[model samples]
Target: MLDRSRTREGHSPAEALRDTVEFARRAEALGYHRFWVSEHHGVPGVAGSAPTVLAAAVAAATSRIRVGTGGVMLPNHRPLVVAEQFGVLESLFPGRIDMGLGRSVGFTGPVRRALGHDKDDADRFEGQLAELLGYFTGANEVPGLPAEGLRVPAFVLATGAGAGIAARHGLPLVIGAVRGEEPMLRAVRDYRAEFRPSPLAAEPYVVVSLSVAVAATAEEAWRLLVPEAWAMAHSRTRGVFPPLRPAAEVLALPMTARERSLFEQSLRGHLFGTPAEIAESLDALVARTGADEVLVTTSTHDRAALLDSYRLLADAAGGR
Candidate 1:
């Protein structure tokens, strides 16, 4: 499961962090294979700005369930710094750390400027990713500390262009099912066909990350997904991803027709239903994408409802 520790309207950031750690422990107990955190710089809706730091807290909180970055945006920081950070993580957690890298820059121009990244930085992701990976083996050594033989397994947060990079490096690809089914499947197909085996991976591997929620009733599950959807829609229209409002409040909000259209479009990327319905959709999605594993990334305004959604999902996934 992946949690951005999204800031809810009434809850403080500290509470979000606490909820994240608690959620991680519960996920471990529920037999989840891995728990990951995301990085969203300068977004009011997201509290997980430093994924590695949050991941460390998660690792310390749980004995199982591999912890990782849903991704560290490569363009935001130097490869050497990332190497040292993940090196420290691997050193502490040993075999339980994951180095998931992404190509995105900050969401807006000001944020990108703050990170000292240019507009063209997005084009340099492949190079940055290579440098970061090389740091793990000291292949393209960057002096200072020797990170020559560290073993923090790396995964690429595959998107349109990132899929090629992941294939070229032979790292496992973690693609989101939210990107539309056909496009995601095509990306996977291209990734597998072009894959070149390396020491890191013997063959192509795919992990399909899904925005999913489950409950006893389909209506309740859909309600749980509304807060995040509204948050996303608000971000698109307002240019600021504010903290999530209550689902009821979100539903009652007066929006322009265009904003309403965008809201429904955002909701299309997510899956929410009764456990059986979710399981069936998940199975079909997995089969179509040929995903080696599925990563569940879910969030909601209500912590109790969020936890219940995960519990229901766990039961459906046969993790319980």
Candidate 2:
């Protein structure tokens, strides 16, 4: 998981970049497979505005673990530029770069405008994704296109019809499973059914990213998750970015019983508990989804607590 909160809380962008590099290095040392950084614009609680830049830093800082965007919102940028960025990253990192592209703008109108994108941008995301893959695969070299000879391992971040596009292109698919399992399972099925062999990936590969907070006790973990839960609740109701508040403050805020129940249910699929318990839960989740990989996103205000959560998760995954 990426440390979005570090950049959100008084740390400069440079500091957040350096911290991410160090974090990736530590994750590699601890035997984690890949370190993914998310993309969020105009959100004070998330500093990963430029995922590719941070990905390059993490790639340079670590020798083993793969580094990439948990996703880059494809509609916001030119596909060729995206291709070149990942191409350059691949050139630098060789075998350890992943390009996960998402269709969502990840923001509302104002932030999207600030990012130089409009609402119609999302409509073109599918076509742009196709163009991106074409560029990477040397298919867009008819007359005057920037991408003639470039190819990298690309995965699409699918929440809906994007899954079908991933299948058509034969790209690996990563589903954001924060909402529920049904959408994810359907996407997985669609991706697998429509998958066609490609140079980058011949078989279907599915990865799921979800909220996770593990502690010595379930109660402690639940407490740590209050910030995230509250964030979700606020996002659902208010539709704005709120500063990361204390968990006590979160709990103290007025909440209907139904709202509280929704938050609890939202937290259910997450891997939380002691090492052994997490491992068992993780194994079951993987089994249920047949996912090749799982990305854990922990919502914590304390950096130490966040690191400890990842360490415990790594241990649960049978890593030292």
Candidate 3:
């Protein structure tokens, strides 16, 4: 997990990075197995803009936790660059690195352009994923290969149509369970049925990334997440990026009925409540999808609160 959301007291990016390092150290101390940072372009609230760079920082700070993206949107950059970056990370961290790649742009049009990518870039993601794998396996023969013959574990992040690709590639698959249990279960079943063993993976592996925020009380967790709900609602109507505001402040703003619906739906896959409540939800999620692991993504403004949430979750989940 990554400490992602912006601080209301105006913390600098350097401060945020240091806080993230400390957060990773705490999570490692608590016995979490892996720490994954997300890549989001042009999002004001999320400071994990470059997951690879952040992964390096976290890796350098913590000695044991496996660190990687959860994930890096493959269509946004060249696959070779990604291969080289992860190669270097693998060199530095050895067996404690994992790469999770996704096909979505994770942003809107203007921001995508600023990142040197266009809408149609997603169409080439499958081919690029293959090329990236080849680079890691030292099978790709492109000019000026960086750290050839170095293999790093890689996984694919899939939602709808991309599940088949994960099966075909035989890479560990992570499904976004935002829709519901039915879709996620079906997708997992399909992936397992179609899986072919690869050198990196002897059997099918599934990780479901779900939204969760745990606190001492359900209402407190819900109240803290209202700002996230509001930001998601604003994004559906106004586009990808939105400024952060206090939950109370966001709730006071006028919104249409449809916008309200979108807000609720945006939080559908999330488990927001006390530790016991979140644990029950997570247990159901794991039982339903049969996921090997669950990657949690929390949306909160306060860093300490975010760390506390994970601490509760770790205790509830019976540790690593």
Candidate 4:
């Protein structure tokens, strides 16, 4: 489960964060293997700004569930700093920490400038990743705190050109299952074919991520996606990403042709429906891509319903 700790229309950022911790507990009890939080900066709809800090909170709050970032953007910070943070986390949490890293800097120009990185900084992700791994393996001369001999499982998020990078580093690849299946499948195929064994991993591994909402009926599940879809459309068109609103409220608002088009576009490529429907979809997805794991990232305005969706999904997937 990769939660962004989205703030709803009526909730405060603090409340949203607390909700994430509580949700983590629910997810653990429901048999989830890991609970991951995401990183987002200067986004009105998201409250998960500092992923490592939030991860510490989650780790301290839960005992059995694995905790980590869905990821921390490497281009935005020095690799040594990230290595130190994760080292501390691993020291405290031991085996339950994961280091999911990404190359994204910021969404807009101002945000990028604020982060002290330009767009091209993302091009250095491969080097940054290598350096981060070097710190863990003691390949670097700099003697450090716990960063030098700690092994926190690291996974590379497949953002542009990321599939190749993961393969070259012999790390686990985390790719989205959306934006159509053909391209995603091709990337995974290429990753496996081009993979090189390293100290981190001996074989290619893929974790496919996508938003999923399971309900008693198809319509109910579909409605659960409306909040996120609307928010995405508004962000793309207006440049202002607001909090999630109720589906009924969003449905009643009038949208321009472009907004309507973007709204529908955002709603595509998701897994939603009853348990039987989702079970079939999961089986086909695994058979098609041979994904090692499915990382579910679903968001909605209805908190109780959101929890229900995961519960149903756990029952449907049966600990997979």
13-64 per-residue lDDT for model 2 (tens digits): 5665576777787789888888888788887556678888888878878888
RMSD of 2: 2.7
lDDT of 3 by residue, 146-258 (tens): 54677678888887767888898888998876577778788989999999888778899998887788899988787667767777788778875464567677777787998
- Identify the leading candidate in terms of TM-score: 4
Candidate 1 runs further than 4 Å off: 143-146
lDDT of 4 by residue, 198-312 (tens): 8778999999999999999999999999999999999998898899999999999899999999999999999999999999999998999999999999999999999999999
Give the C-alpha miss distance for residue 301 in model 1, angstroms. 0.7
> How well does candidate 4 score on lDDT at residue 24?
96
lDDT of 4 at 106: 93
Between prediction 2 and prediction 4, the one with superior lDDT is 4
Better of 1 and 2 by TM-score: 1
Clashes of 4: 0
User: Looking at model 1, which ten-residue stretch has the lowest summed lDDT?
Assistant: 139-148
Q: What is the lDDT of residue 318 in candidate 1?
A: 94
Candidate 2 at residue 95, lDDT? 79
lDDT of each: 0.87, 0.76, 0.79, 0.93
